[model samples]
Target: MQNKLLGVIDATTHKNGIEDLITNRSMSAIPFAGRYRLIDFVLSSMVNSGIESVAVFHGFQNRSLMDHLGSGREWDLNRKRDGLFFFPSPLKEPDSDQLGSFKQFKQNIDYFYRSDSQYALISNCHTVCNMDFESILQRHISTHSDITEIKHDGQSLEMYIIETSLLIDLVQNEETTGYRSIVDVVRDSRNTYKVSEYEYIGYAALINTIEKYYKYSLEIISPQIWKQLFLKDRPIYTKVKDEPPTRYNKGAVVKNSMIANGCVIEGHVENCILFRGVKIGKGTVVRNSVIMQKSQIGENCELDAVILDKDVKIENGVTIKGTETIPHVLRKGTIQGALMNS
Candidate 1:
């Protein structure tokens, strides 16, 4: 059978209660890695996988996403039959309370089911990774799993892991031999067993599962209970990443850093996460900072613990060592020794 249609949910939002302040802006659109945006990872992966159709669910602050992913021309997602689509959040809902991420996803259920495709691939844009979906689809078909959860290494301890076999059984409702709560499956080793399939990489696979069994609103459905019901019995599959993981470029000198794409550095950097399109002049020193997109730092400027917002400019001979414990936030401009957060 032809591979199912693919749907990608940008699911990124500004911190709640701050949406009005940053209207039409999405967290996914936030610039990252030097020159690349965060959504690029997901979009690129989808494009590379030969999945032609993609829909980006924009919640708020989506202008950046719209700007960067314009018409999906760059990734060749602008096809006549299967191309990139932008799904804006519905402005008029009968019940405004259904505004959370889960609810927003639930509202888009029609898009997933209405598609002529047989399978669905769902993912978020918060992570950056290289994935070959052809292999994943092969594994999914061979295993005949209802749901496939992708997991990556280096996740925090707070994350949870579920076995594929157990997940399949739970979703099929074949685990119950007597009266028991769904959580009991986790406790009962005999009924629930582990299978090495794909780890849950915060992404999920649904083989028409949602279209088949979804009844109640996503807001009312408890995630724990849902996991217990479907995931407890369903046979979950795993896909281990055997290839060498990708890392930052070696020519890039990042210190105490969280660096993203589209960056070129030939200077000394310490304690910074430089976003995309950030350029550090040679012979410059940056310490304890968070620099946003397209920002430039002149040579020989010593910056200590500063948070430079997008498009900020720092001129040469500007020594910015502040006494405040909290790093100063520098707006867009050329400055010297400007006290941030003052």
Candidate 2:
């Protein structure tokens, strides 16, 4: 990616079937891998590739998204010139609904105009992968394509690079009802425009539902995938937490787990992802679970194949178990005991 290339991230839409995790925040803000949000993967990829000018379009309950991406300084996106720009929701009418990226982009066309970039890289924040967008941009420029899309598993990552003029034309005339989405415009214009495809030979993912989320979360636990995504040459950056390292008490027994900082373990955790400030009380058992930030599990509690959202509290004497394909989910700030099924 060159300095002339600008990045645009779609963080406005709501992802269905993930209501439990995305009720209060955009899907991009969803926590992942103990210490990272889904957006970090994409943002880091762009920043690592030397693309400084970036815009994150946000809506549908975006306070957490705002807090998480303050100033974009962490990713080195806060700069003198083309730096991080956030386009907030513009649907302020009484009857207007929550905004989406297309509308947000249309309203903020001045950002694109003043950017002076010849090309733009557009992507959704849901896919969790570490990719070199420079390759994608090179292919787009070499092929002289109007739009070059990256695909994996027969579906577009919703990642594309387009000539800025073509994007302007498509978006400027998007007054009709049928062409609200970028996909729709690209599809409808295929006959008139030159569209190309580049297969991504990396760990491309689509985590839309809870089951898929749980499945992918566990899949990354594989050392190969973990190394490829997080520990590669270009590191994945996130908000720095200056907490101390995790502490394991005398009775602690952890195996095949990824534990982050600010955790205290006195029980057993197997094949789990423990985020910052999580506490596993003595005698508690966690297997095949993902416990997010600041959650606590009381003693004698047993959790298997579960996804506990942030700030959840599980009392003692509870055993919550679900199958591998369909893990039970406890929503954010939930308090659970023996009777609660969530």
Candidate 3:
């Protein structure tokens, strides 16, 4: 099922507000579910769909991306030919106007020219879903489309499967038009290029805003969504971690939560997602929240609709509450909680 396919994860753009939760990491590297990054969905979807080659364009804090993807072996992308490639942007550019996304593509035009794949699947690490791109590839071939992209509710997911030659032609023809981004090209291509759109039902969360992020993080609580995301045909792969099973002490109580490995729970957790290495001290009560890796929550604390970023420390007897619509967020590595004694 090669279909002469090549994948390009065009995730170099910045997503505002997500920086508030994590300052030193790219959005693609932000952990999701229990143990996966946002990029894991896109990369896994592609790899599960039989893509052998992928190129990730890094925007800022690329070190985080490098740390997560390492050798691409987790996704089975380490190959002698047509594996993974990293394209890094300079720390400082001459001007903002010169940093157009199309300009970035023009700089890396040799990659597309050098590849023998007939089709280029351009995607972003936004939508979190398990999907197979094979049907869309077949659709593109059957329709003889210059570009075939997926759309949900009349919105393109920024994942386009276009003919490689058409992409090269677009790059060559739109060199100096001050093109803003690839979306601009596709938006205007209806007139110049043959374009086809397929409806996609893969939107479990529109995570551009904090509210959406919080909302979608809890969507996994649903039996339908959980089965669709994890128990489906293709497995979502990520960097493996060797840790013992989550330990729930005699007094610990868990209800409707997804807790990962390396967690020690001695309190009560309800409707939450806990990443690895989290330690919930005795007598704490947490509800409707997402606590990331290595965070420590002291005893007698009460939290509702909160998102504690990785490595956060919450002291005892403190209370933090926010609505599910707009959950309170603690940035990465921030320490919260009152230094109080019972």
Candidate 4:
């Protein structure tokens, strides 16, 4: 079954609602769950499903995505055989930035043509789930369906399993057929293809907007939610950073937070998720926030319901607060000081 299936991940779509966090990175590379990127969940699922050859199609803002998925070593896809392949879209402006984009796929049609796989598992990079594509493939085969769309609670997860030949055919004749993407083909009533849906009962979160991102990030703080996403046998893989254990200094009071490695906490943190190498200075109080990698919060500062990007520095006595619905977002490399706020 592994030899008969190929993995294709679409990482090019950009959401206007998520613009704040994606200013310097693609949606797929957005930091999540303390140490992993949004793409890690889907990519790891493909690898865990025994799909050896995987291709990631990305857009212009691909520096961070490329850097994070360099050779796909962390996912054990760095091999001499048919391993991880990356294809950047040639279009400076695509006709449409949708999942299973045929425009981008048309740019690298040779990849689909040359593969020996019988079927393809196409997925979006931003969906957070620990899925087994093999199960979907089995159902597709048993049902004799042309396209199998995976859904969670009757909502589309934007994942599909289709024959490789049919996928190539759709990409090749997209203009003639007037089909922009897999969604278009599936929606068309004139098509003879048998479309099916496989209900996914597991925990799945699609991080497409700021609200959903913030909601899911905090939701995973619960052990029950994180347990569903991170399985013992099928673990999500990410670029490993060798960092020392997190240190909780004297006077630090943390409750219900998830802190990654190489962190130094001397402040009070409650219901926050701190990524790798974050520093909470003495006398600070942080609550219900998602702080990314290497961000430093200064002494006596207070942050609530905020999302700080990587390398953000909150200076002494800075007080920033926002609601859960519209959390304050500090872009990457930005420094917020008390004087700035005053």
Supply every candidate's count of residue pairs whose N, Cα or C atoms clash at under 3 angstroms.
Answer: 46, 0, 0, 0
Q: Which pairs clash inside model 4? A: none
TM-score per prediction, in order, is: 0.56, 0.94, 0.93, 0.97
Give per-residue CA lDDT, model 2, range 194-267, as digits (tens): 88989998887877789999999988888988877875588888988788999999999999999999999999
lDDT of 3 by residue, 1-342 (tens): 857788888656566656675478776787889898888998998999889889887776778789889989999998899888988754342222222255667778899999998898888766787877888899989998877878877876667888888777777777565455557766774466678898887644545567777888888877878887884568998998899999999899999999999999999999999999999989999999999999999998999999989898898888888996778888888777585321
How much is the lDDT of residue 303 in candidate 2? 92
Candidate 1 Cα lDDT to native: 0.51
Residue 40 displacement (Å), model 1: 0.6
Specify the highest-lDDT model's number. 4
Q: Which stretches of candidate 3 lie over 4 Å from their true place?
A: 90-100, 176-178, 202-204, 339-342
Error of 2 at 97 (Å): 14
Q: What ranking of all candidate models by TM-score puts the best one first?
A: 4, 2, 3, 1
Kindly provide the TM-score of model 4 when superposed on the true structure, using C-alpha atoms.
0.97
Using lDDT as the measure, what is the rank order of every candidate, best first? 4, 2, 3, 1
Give model 1's TM-score versus the native structure: 0.56
User: What is the C-alpha local distance difference test score of candidate 2?
Assistant: 0.84
Steric clash pairs (candidate 2)? none
lDDT string for model 4 (54-149, tens) is: 999888889999999998989999999889999987768533347888878998999998999999999988999999888889999999999999
Residue 238 local lDDT, model 4: 95
lDDT of each: 0.51, 0.84, 0.80, 0.92
